[model samples]
Every structure is written in structure tokens, then in C-alpha cells.
Target: MDDASDKYRAPALEKGLDIIELLANHGEGLTQRELAKSLDRSPNEIYRMLSTLVRRGYVIRSASGDHYSLSLKMFSISQRHPPIGRVIEAALPRMRSLTRKAWQSCHMGMESNGDIVIVATAESPGNWGLALKTGTVVGLWNTGTGRVLAAFRTPEEIDDLIARHRRAVGEPEVVRAEFDGHLARIRTAGYEKMPSATAVGVTNLAFPVFNPSGQVVAVLSCPYLERVDDLVVPPIDEVVEIYRTLANELTALYGGTNPFEKDLTP
Candidate 1:
């Protein structure tokens, strides 16, 4: 190799990054021996690398001292980037607008670290709305927003994310497979309107928000509730149609294409 090539190479940094990416893809984690075997390095060589990664807060060691996994540090770091900021910036107003239109609470979330994290939320105008605060993280398999986000990704990406979500929720592999099928159905339907897995008497309505490449960058979801109000609440079916408009509007605001539009073409 040339001197210039040697100068640009940082072997140690590369090894550390390799470990991080592997753990991220795996989600559950790997043992030190497993990491070494996967990386084609000696355990002792990788031990120092793991130690450095753990100390720098990029990775965490289990209490057993035999396994390793990624910490949330990287996910936190990603939230500070411009793309995430722009997504949040472009989402809040739309979230509120959709909420006001339907008189239901809505939230926006994106997948991170094997979970769907609520980044912004707008409550229904009165005190009768369902409210989930910002920074709340929910499993990817059960939430409507989670399914919408999952439905838009490639199969490989879905597999990886579901594996992690399964580990997080401790659900059975059979359930995981069912969740995969559920996402496929959601893709065909172009939206998800179902009962909340965690809360009762509330229906979850979710739509996908896309980036310029038509990849789902975020999910806009609302928990639909009926109140004994002054007879002005939109029915659940109308709420679903309204969310469709909001999804298309937000997708266009970000210069994103709606994949379902192509499915609808004659």
C-alpha cells in the first residue's frame, strides 16, 4: 500500500465501527467470543476494542461480563443530525393540524434502536384525548405507527428490526412471524386502523411519512377515541380518510412519493 493509503487508514477505529454495526444489526447482542469469531480477530485483540467502545459510551457490557451490545448513545447522536431535525420541524405542525381536524391525539415517530420512539405529540383540543408524551418508546410489532414504519422498509430491514423488537418485547418467534405477515397486510391496505395493544377502547390510526426517496422516514399516528361530546366528533372512518390526506400532504412537503399511489394506478 502507498504511504498516503496507510496514512488514511485507522485499523483500530475500523474494528470498533465493525463491532458497532454488527451489534446494531443483531439487536440482542453478541458475546465477546462471538464478536471475535465474527470479526476474524483473536478474542484478546477484540477485548481491548470492546473495552474502548464500552468506555466511550458507544457500547455496553452486560452484567455477566460475557456479552456486549450497543448503547443508546448512537441513537441519541442521530437525533441531533439535520435530517432528524428537519423531519421533526416539518412534522409538528402537520401533526397538530391533523389532530385538530379529527379531535384526536396524534404523534409522530421513527424507528430507532429496535423501537418506535414518539418524537412529537398533539393532544385533541379538549381534555378528552388520548395522550402519549414525547420520548415514549413502544415495541415495533404492536403499535399502529410501528406497523406503518415497518411496512415501508425492505424485507431485510424488516427482518433485522423485528428481531430486535422481539428481543425487546420477549414475544415468541411465532408471534414475530405473525407480525411480519401483519406488516405485509398493512402495506397492501395503505394504512393501519386497529385497537391499541396497550390501551383499551382506543383505536390506532397510522400513516407513513416519507423522505424524498419514498422511504418511510417517520410515522404519523393517532389514537382514536369517542367521547360523549356535543355531537361534532368525526366518525372513525372519516378520521381514517383525513389521515390519508395528511399523510399525502406531509409526504409532498418533504418531497416524498407515496408508494401506494403507484399501486392505485390503472
Candidate 2:
């Protein structure tokens, strides 16, 4: 009665740390048996811990097969908490300025399950604007923002997205080919700009936002209408430059250095 309680204080905390460390050291994911062996724990213990991690969004089961790997929920948590929250809050003022200067609505979106979902939005200064509200889900095959997100993902992720979407939506080969072609262009251009997927005569110009490790985490986009042949203001070059500058600013603010700075120029 005077010994056991003091010695075994928190098994749950220890189990969580063990699972994290095991996954970190393994690089490639481990099955329950392997994880158990590495941690010197029983398979049942490891399985329970893994199940919890998966439920909490800290781990994800591989789509290609049965395996577990770290998820970006940790990143999402960091973005939500302080320090990083301050940075994102500061970045919004600049996003608003860019939106006004370009006479276009702007959106910030992050990739989730292969789709891009808008998390923030700023309206154009003009009375008439092409606006996309926060939480708008962009299709991977059709939008500029979606293309940037798709381009930055790993090949396996791209394949998995395509496969899953195809199964769910029954997309034809022509649609797949079109998306592939857009992806190739995004890689070539180092950014994505195209006519709006959902609205007629509007265009979207987008650049990818990267983290310190050079992984694209989100995208910044401006939605605007194409000017008539007589108009000269808000040139495409100027808008692209603004997008690039915002991308760089966000990168630096978040402790990330730009890897595509040299490649971004026309």
C-alpha cells in the first residue's frame, strides 16, 4: 500500500511518449508487433496506444496499405496555439492590403484529405467582387489553389487522392488527364494561375505557403475578373509579384526560408 502507487504514477503518459519516440526513430512506419518490440512493450499495449493516437488525429493509417504514420494534426495544433497564432494574425493585415491593391477577393486555404479548404477570406474593395467564403472546398481537378496543393504533395499522396476521388466521384480518364496536365504546369511555373473553376470570366492566381521543412502547408489566392481589352490597371505581372511577396513574407514570419525565391521570377 505504501509502494506501488508512488512507483507507477502515470502509465498513460509514458505509453504516449513511447509511441511517439518509436515512430520518430523508425522513420518508416512500424506495425503493432514491431512497435511493441522496439518499445519493449506488449502488442496489446502498443495497439491501444496507436488506436488512441489515430483517434486523436496524431497518426494516420496508410491509404496504400495497412500501416500508421504521423499526421499533420500536430501542425494544425501549432498553428492554432500562441506564437504561431500571432504570426498568422499578423499575416492577415498584409493579406487584406494585397486584396485591396489587386481589386480582388483573397482566400487562404490548406490541404485536407487531398482537397483544399479555405480557412480565411478577404473581400475586394470594389462593390462588385468575385467572393469565396471561408470553408469553400476547391476541387483538385479544377482550381488553381487545388493544383498548387496537389503539386506539393508526395507522389503517393497524389496517387491516393486520385484513386479515392475516382472511386467516390467516378471521374473519367479525360478528367484525370486534365488534372495531370495542370499539375505539370504548376511545377513548371512555380505557381498556379488560371480562370476560375466555379465562376465564369473570373481568374485565380495562387502561390503555395511552405513550412520550415519546405513542405507546402497552405495556399494564398486572389480571385478577380478578367479585365476588358481596353483596361490597363492591375496587370497580371503586378498581381503575380504581390502573391510572391506575400508568400515570402508568410514564410519568413513562420521561421521558414523561401526555397523557390529564385525560381519564382518570370
Candidate 3:
């Protein structure tokens, strides 16, 4: 820490923030003793902070009163931020239309600190569809959403994104040469269509959403599932076209150009 900047720190505020950050990573909740041990402090040092957090609705005390986890308050607060709020608001109606047309659930995600964070989603109006919830963090190398986000960036930016990436659990390691080639193909096609790395029997179709500068801002993806029984949906080819149109409409929300109309080679 910088001594000058740290000279007048509020220790209590630091403790409260620390407790909140710790709880965010532990979805199962943590006991007071567990929190203390993780922070290398005594339980008594954090008791008041934890109690305050629970009372204020930022953290939830378990039914047994022994564990603490974050409530939805932080997520609720984050969604109200203007930039993300605008993206979600604009994406939802389009996403709903996409689900209606394609009969598949779709999600919009953006790269944040080298991770793809699903920001908004629309569910299929059909009987069943796979959907990832908002706030889920997915890895860059193993997902169609991640590939589309990286495919439109400059080579240097792509390198830096990979370097800073923290892999999610069960995400496979990347081979730089092969992954580079994969991105090249996405750039060539202006999108990605591949079987999901983590699931069987589903193909993931992803397209880039860009800003006015032609820089990719987010990705719109559909986890495409084919029905084996009597239920029928649009064929994958038609669904891909419908999805690409949705992506273009979203990009237009930012005054972005259509990637299909330009040569994306860099």
C-alpha cells in the first residue's frame, strides 16, 4: 500500500468492504469463524460488520443463523447503473423477439476484466430451453460468447485479454496456436457456431455486438438445442439468420456498423 494514500484509512469501513468481497465468492455462505480464519482476524473483529451487513440487506444470515451470504441487493444496485442499464433495457426486447422467432433462449454478455459476464437473458417461449442466469461469469477460451467478444478485437488486445483471463472451474486450457486459428475463423465468418465445450447435445451460436467505432462491445448468443421428439422449432440455419439479425439490430442501438458488410481482417 502507498503510505501517503493509506495514512488516514478508515479501518472499520475496510473491514466491512472486505467482509462483503469475501462473501461474494462463497455462494454457500460462510460462518463467522470461517470468515475470520480466511481474513486472518478473530471472529469478534468482524462480528459487528457482519451484523450491520445483514441488517442493511446486503448480506443474508442463514436460516440457522450460523452462515452469511450476499443477498441480491448488490446485483440490484449494479443493474441500475446507466451504461449496463441501457444495454440490458435495449437488449431485452430484442432478445425476447429473438426467443419468439427462434424458439430458443438467448443471452447477452460482455467481457469484463477478461471474463464474460451474462448481463441480460430472454427465455424461450417454447416448452424447454437452456438459459444461463445473470451474474454468471464464464471463461474466455471455452465459450462461443467469449470467442465472439475476442474475434473483433485487435491482435494486441486479444493477447492482453488472454493474459489477464482467470479460468472458470472446469474450463479447458487453451492452445495459443489453435485458439488463434479459431478466432481467425470467427472473424472470417463474422460469428461463431460450435458445439458447447461444457454441454452435450447443444450447439452455441454467437454474434458480436459492436459500438459505433466498430469495436465489439458485447456478444449475443443462443445455446441452440435441437428437439428429438415431436416438438419442432426453426432449423439451425434459419435460427442463425434470425440471431444474426438480432445482433445487428443491437449493434445499431450503438450506431455500430454491420460486421458482415465490412472486411474485419486486421
Candidate 4:
């Protein structure tokens, strides 16, 4: 290779990035031997790379021996970027409006590796409220947002997600059966409403936001207190309708050239 080409190339940097990308793409952590095999490198070479990554806080070793995974450092890196930042910014105003209209806490969440992560949230003005902060992570089987996101997935995908979580959390068989029933209802209703699995005396209303490919990329959710005297508690049917409208509007706004034209009729 020429001197200029040699000057531009950095084999060490490339190898480190390859390791990071592989860990990021995998749903589960990779053992040292697995990483070496995937990267076509020796264990010693992979160990040094992994050590540097661990020191830099880009990766962490699991409690179980020799396995490695990416860390919150990746989320910090994404927060500085414009694309995701802008999406959160644009969605906040609408999220706030929805919260005010329904008199409940509302959230904009996206599926990340089979978990629902809240990106934006608006708190209810009432004294009794459902408080879900941004960055809150919820199980794919427990919440309305989780169920709606799961509804868009294929059976194999859902099974994979359930199995992964079952290994991690050891959810009871009865709970799994109930969640399966919830998924069926979400598929039929085109939306999901369930008593809050994460919080007490609250109900979650969730609907999926589709991209231009008719794929569910995100979810919009409202967590409302189950109180009779609350003026902000809109009727269930109206709340569902409003959520459907908002999801359609968001699809149009972000759909770009691949405009989302999915049938959201419920």
C-alpha cells in the first residue's frame, strides 16, 4: 500500500470498532471465546480489545464468567446525535398536549432490543398521577406499550423475546399465559389497554406507531389513574380514538419519503 493509504489506516481502531458493533447487534452478551471466533481473532487479541473497552466504559463484563456486553455509554453517545434528539424534541410537544387532554401522564417510547424505553414523558397535572420518567425501561410482557410493540412482531419474534426474558426474569407460567392473551387482544383491537403492571391504581393505554414500511417502530402511551372523580379521565373509547389519531399524525410527520399509510382503523 502507498504511504498515504498506510497513514489513513488504523488496524487497532478498526478492530475495536468491530468488537463494539458485534456486541451492540447481539441481544445477549458474548463470551470471550465467542467474540474471538466471530472476529477471527485470537483470545489474547480479543482480551486486550475488551479490556480497553471496559476501561473506557464502552463495555462491561457480566457477573457470569467471561461474557461481555455494551453499556449505557452507547446511549450517551446517541443522545448527542441530531436524528434521535430531534425526534424526541418534536414528539415532546405532542406528548404534552396528549397528557393535558387526557389528564394523565403520557410517554413516547421505542422498542430497544425487545424492551420498551421511554424517550419522552409528560406528567399529569392532577395530585394523583402516574409518574414515569424518561429512560424508564419496562418488560415486553407487562405493559400496554410493550404489548402493542409485541403485536407488530411475528410469532417467532415474540417467542424469542419471551424466552429471553424468561431466562432473565423467570416470569411465572401463568403470567406468560396472561401476557399471551393480552397480545392476542392487542392484535385484534389494534391498541392495548391494561391495568398498570408496573404501578398501582393506574391503567395504560398504548398504541403502535408505524413507519413507512408498515412496521411498528415506536409506541405512544398514556398512564391514567383509575379514579372516578377525575375530570381528566376521558372515556375509554375516546381515549383510544385520540391515541389512534395521534399515532396516525406522527406516522405522517416522520414517514418521510416512505410515508406510513398503514391501516390503523380500530
For each of the candidates, the C-alpha root-mean-square deviation to the true structure, in angstroms, is 7.9, 12.8, 2.9, 8.8
Could you tell me every candidate's TM-score relative to the true structure?
0.67, 0.62, 0.89, 0.63
Top TM-score hit: 3
All candidates in order of TM-score, best leading: 3, 1, 4, 2
> Which digits, one per residue and each the tens of the lDDT, describe model 4 over residues 1-266?
99999989999998999999799667489999999999999999999999999999999989975789988897787667664575666677887787677667788787666556787788876776776777766667777777888887788988876665421132223376777888888877777777876667777888777766677777888876666773546776676677667776776676732122354443
After superposition, which runs of candidate 4 have C-alpha atoms over 4 Å from their true positions? 1-74, 80-83, 163-177, 230-233, 256-266
Model 1 backbone overlap count: 0
Please give, for residues 1-266, the per-residue lDDT of candidate 2 as tens digits.
Answer: 46877697788888887787567545478777788888889988988889999998888777764677777676577578664365468667898888778877788776665555677778877766776776555666777777787887778888887665421122223376777888888887788888876678777888887777777767788876766656355877788888778987887777777667788764
Superposed model 3: Cα runs more than 4 Å off: 1-17, 261-266
Backbone clashes in each candidate structure, one number apiece? Answer: 0, 0, 0, 0
Better of 2 and 4 by TM-score: 4
Can you write out model 3's per-residue Cα lDDT over 133-244, one digit (the tens) per residue?
8888887888999988988888999999998887876888878888898899998889999999999999999988888888888899999999788777799999888888
Worst 10 residues of 1 by lDDT: 165-174
TM-score of 1: 0.67
2 versus 3: better TM-score goes to:
3
Candidate 1 CA-lDDT value: 0.81
